[model samples]
Target: MGDENRTGMTEFYFRPFSSLPKVQLLIFLILLLMYMVSVCGNGTIVLIVCTDCSLHTPMYFFLANLAAMEICYSTIIAPLTLANLTSLRKATISLAGCGIQMFFFIFLGGAGCVLLAFMAYDRYVAICHPLRYTIIMSWTVCVSIVAASLALGFLVSLNMTILIFHLPFCGTNEIYHFFCDIPAILHLLACSNTHAHQVALYICSVINVAIPFLLICFSYAFIVVTILRISSGAGWHRTFSTCSSHLMVVALMYGCSSFIYLRPSSSYSPEQGRVVSVVYTFVTPVLNPLIYSMRNKELKDALSRALGRKVLHQSK
Candidate 1:
């Protein structure tokens, strides 16, 4: 019905949230503050990782890449959202721009999800097979894993974006939420039967979100078993502390993402979706990098040394 009607319809408008100007301004400020925090937090991690030779381990390497991804991931969605919040009623994104946003949104997001699982595996190997940790997680293997994760993420995002924009948008051009979310577009906006599209989305979500989460869980199961066998007394806390940061990140990423993507579009509530999207998009990106670098003693020590060196350079 909408194929021809949608041919020239190359723009999508974002609907306003709060009718009150004060409320909109408040939201904008808060979002901007959080976005800045996310950028600095992730940016610090990247800087320290690259500068500090002590943090050149595989885990920190992955952490640096993950931080870089968060910085980019949030930038992809947050600025546009902040702008929308300020304007309140009149914000429009071109069709191509929207598709590009969706592509990187999924690419970085899916890659980050998979990278978490790999980090879990790194913990697993270091704990379960301590003697072979070096061999098992070789630099070559880590780089390859990261490369594969990105390639796979890119391919999946490309396919999803193409399928989505290919649909006819002959009807309402108003998006109910901040960005071009898959369900928001597929269910509410696309003027076509989305049975096949929904199925594809569901399958990808399972592969990207569910499967990686399960893998993390599986790896952690072995990690717990191995930790219990080797440590007791005060050793228990010390042994588990290394993984606690990662586990928290896993919980946050999977919990919010699953809530957002792991369901049928028929049950998608626009209000609820926007609220939850804030968590994974804004909150997690801020917290994940902080927890990894800020909370880790080794990274902290490295940062201290870097600061010491910086101060010495300035003094000299």
Candidate 2:
């Protein structure tokens, strides 16, 4: 089903991993476990934040949004990846389906990036300016930040998707990577004079990934400075504890994404890109809930209470 037209491309096929069947099987199993964990883990975070009254605050509000984004992010790619791995025949995706996948992948990913930055800001306020933290991070402001993050994410992703898909894919219908990401798609483009397109992609990456990452770092820089100014050892420990989880999440999300998107398309390697993509797309989501739950005692206690209530209701 490899037909090309003047308007747009129709469908695309995915290249199977070059490894042996046993290796493919192992990869499939690992991806399956990762998918389940990402879903369940992020799902639990969302559920606990929603049901637990104690978690009804700006920090947890942003966290719930992040968890929801992670769930959506994993769902967009992981299931299709699993199906492709298990299928006997080569995996094919319709042009419309491919566009949709790319859209959500970028959308949720961008939202998560901004959301993490907001979480850092949240901690910054809570720690560095504890006196006016409540007034500064009111419920109204929190909701506005979330709405802005979602809107900004959609705007950037829409621009990138439109720009990438507008190019003709007349050469090869086979995508070398596991998913329909920008770098992978650009690598398959049969067009000439793609310098402008690549430049636009790099710009988008800079604005979305690199900038937010810098903002997170900036917020934490101030946070660390403010923490050190305090004399109490307990104060230092408490301040650091609040932000450690967010810092870890920022490192994981930005590290892989920046590597994939921040560079020129000429440097794109399908095999390396696929492996690195696994980090942010699959592994990071699974690790996020674990990182947060493990580091945040408040979250752990909230989870316990939520589970306890579930057990109590079921036993009745």
Candidate 3:
């Protein structure tokens, strides 16, 4: 009865969440909380950076950009994922819709990586050459860096998305992973001899993943060496404190990215890939504002003062 034969029928099967039994429910709840947290948390960061006169430095400037990108990045994929968990329908997306999602996801994600690298270079100049920090990280240079990052992000993501979307997805429409990542889409293609597509994937990996990671790595390496050379213990602590939060963010972002995208696509099992994708895509954005706001004294004091003023006005 279950195996009734039909003519020219394409049986669509949804990937089941039953694969991850114990932790599936827990992860879903946490991700829902994260979506709200990242939205509100990053929004507050942007507001404080904009309003506070004293906080208008190179670090906060970059922080504002990072927060903005986190909002964009999380918005692209997290809502759909949460819907898939909560609703009855396993929310199907059309090919065009999937392409649009991939574009913003990659674009904002790429931009975030670039800005983080720039932030590291900012710390490097600030600590290693305090005398020249202001001149080096001038207003013009900061604007240029942010602009270049956004430009490169859009260009690279546009190319990759266009190339991947052009491939005919005639065979199967079901993507195994939770969201519309390139590697996840590749798995659904019915075409044989995908050599050309694989080549494009490799090229994108080099540009979007490999190169930016190397830049981040080199920036931190320089930062560490400079921190070590500081003569006094107090001076060393002061220097390390400045960049430690950024370093934590860098670690989590890069670690999750490497797990999801750096490995051979053949190695990612469907269920495992979805789980790992949740880490970098959903989890990392939620962590960004908390890492910076909690650890950085300036942001905390600014936020507290802003809230206290509001409370006072309300009482009056």
lDDT of 2 by residue, 1-316 (tens): 1233336567787877755788889999998999999999999999999989999999999999999999999999998998999888888998888889999898889888988888888998998888999999999999999999999889989988877777768777888888898888877755655778889888878877998989898998998899879999998888778888888998898999988998667788888898899899899999999999999999999989878988999999
Q: Which of the predicted structures, 1 or 3, would earn the higher TM-score when compared with the native?
A: 1
Give lDDT tens digits, candidate 3, residues 44-116. Answer: 9999999999899999999998999899898998887777665555567765677789898888887887888
Q: Score candidate 3 by TM-score against the native.
A: 0.90
Report the Cα lDDT for candidate 1.
Answer: 0.87
Quantify all predictions' global Cα lDDT against the true fold: 0.87, 0.87, 0.79
Q: Which residue pairs in model 3 clash with each other?
A: none
The Cα error of candidate 3 at residue 140, in Å, is: 1.4
1-316: candidate 1 lDDT, tens digit per residue: 1365346678888776677888888988888988999999899889999998888889898899999999999999999998888773588999889999999999999999999989999989988888999999999999998997898789889999988888887677889888988988886787778899989998889878999999998999998888778646666776677899999999999998888888767788999998899888899988887787655888889888988999999998
Q: Point out the higher-scoring one by lDDT: 2 or 3.
A: 2
Query: Once model 2 is optimally superposed onto the true structure by TM-score, how far is the C-alpha of residue 116 displaced, in angstroms?
Result: 1.0
- TM-score per model over all chains: 0.96, 0.95, 0.90
For residue 121, model 2's alpha carbon misses the true position, in angstroms, by: 1.0
